[model samples]
Target: MSMSRTWPVWARTMVSRGIYSRPRTSQERLRRAVEGKTVLITGASQGIGRATASRLAAAGAQVVLTARNESNLRELEEEIRAAGGEAAAYPVDLSQPELIDEMVDKVLAKHAKVDILVNNAGHSIRRSIDLCYDRYHDFHRMTAVNYLGPVKLTLRLLPVMRAAGAGKIVNVSTFAIRTPPFPRWGGYHASKAAFDVWLRAIGPEIRADGVRICSVYMGMVDTAMTAHTPSLHRLPTLTVADAAGIVCDGAAGNRRALGPWWCAPLEAGSVFVGRPLDAVFSRLYQRSSDTDAARRAIL
Candidate 1:
């Protein structure tokens, strides 16, 4: 059985109510929102993006899958098509800005307009400041994939969405950014937070143009992205399917923000008790041991 399935009833209940509750959207609702729409999903080769693509396509959307893994994207494309869904795969590394532009152009050339854009691609790293002293590339790569890439893609597609007078942009952001900052996650947090703030800042400006934006402040999930962090494995996490469902909810629902029930409280705490929270997090960080990956990298 899965780790989530093995959890005690109370433990599961707390997770569902507090940390990361999956949003349940009816198939009929999803179909009504995205049917016949051209939706583009980044990082669609695996994990949440992959699952989201499958779900959206099943709802009658023309799904466009993009990621660095060409083989995986092609395989998913075939799988979607075999299931009687419309899907097209375009493999492009999000870290490459030029490639993103080219891919967007190609997609526009084919589909003319993308009615929904899911900015789901991301790169995550957890390393202490001391460990990163000699690894500036870590910050660079994180910003490249998590921040700049999404911004570029959004800019390219926003004009078309505005011109069409109707569109939705779903940003699959992390819940960590809304809470007190955690140690050893500076680079990752900063990069993701950049895009989060960017999207929210422009949301009002574009709302009048018939473009809507939803930011899903997602919690930990069981995916290749988190597979390397063994400590995270012990925590309650959403399955890829659960995460996908939440993304679909953001796609179909009118909510501006979707996240755990505890998110707002945590955000308030971060603002009111920033210093105390920092001290507590510092103590926790001091007690924690480095991961095997961190040790390997330092060596």
Candidate 2:
């Protein structure tokens, strides 16, 4: 069967256009997209994960927030409750892949079905490969959290999502991947990139089952993760809350695709419109890097 290229591309463009427009008043955009639904968000103790959890709960989602730090997750739960939002805290170590089965069982036992699974948990260390050396476990550790952890968790949820017959999977990806040899991000980039490819490939096969996967390729968003990067690379960054809003918008829209506008220029000439904008981003990134290095050496 011949496919309709325009629908998906147009859908993505329209979604991005809407997410950028008059911008829904927080309350308006948020509404009951969450009502009667349950959501699980990882890395929810802080940053983008926290931002997503707070909004989903406020929008009436019975949100399950998870992170490695139980105390911190509890504190966030209190904050969400104080704001009159529904939330529950779960503490789990994503580094331990074996635990996903148990975690999924626990969430199902309590919530019945997780309507939205935001694979937002991840780790990033701003160090070059040289700094990592024989500490190869560091690579596995980061990949475990930023990639495999989410992939495994997502797979575990598939049965529930398929049974429920409608669901959304949001994978947070980086604009940094546009540039290869992303400065000092060897582990984080490679890991996230691998997961991103895997998610995008399988995302379509399951769409007929009413399971939608939206991969959010974001430019830098200000958070503790970006704390040490030179301000130049981080200046245009969105606040964590702002970034989360964009992500939720995609999930709420239930659209097949959502991503940055820059991808448009880069994607227009692709042999296939849905092909990622990796090539363009890589060249632009190289130029940006040279400019940055030159600026820093003289200062």
Q: Please, what is the TM-score per model?
A: 0.95, 0.79
lDDT of 2 by residue, 1-299 (tens): 11212235455344434433212336555675667688899999889999888888888888999889899899989998999888888788988877777787888899889988888888876554444575687788888998888888988998789888889898888765644344556778989888888988988888888888887776566576765455333234455666788778766876554555555555444445423445665565556433333224221
RMSD of each: 2.2, 9.2
- In model 1, state the lDDT of residue 230: 72
CA-RMSD of model 1: 2.2
Task: Tell me the TM-score of model 1.
Answer: 0.95
- For model 1, the run of ten residues with the poorest summed lDDT: 9-18
| Pairs in clash, predicted candidate 1 | none
List ranges where model 1 is wrong by over 4 Å: 1-14
Whole-model alpha-carbon lDDT for candidate 2: 0.73
lDDT of model 2, residue 220? 63
Candidate 1 residue-wise lDDT at 195: 96
Candidate 2 lowest-lDDT run of ten:
290-299
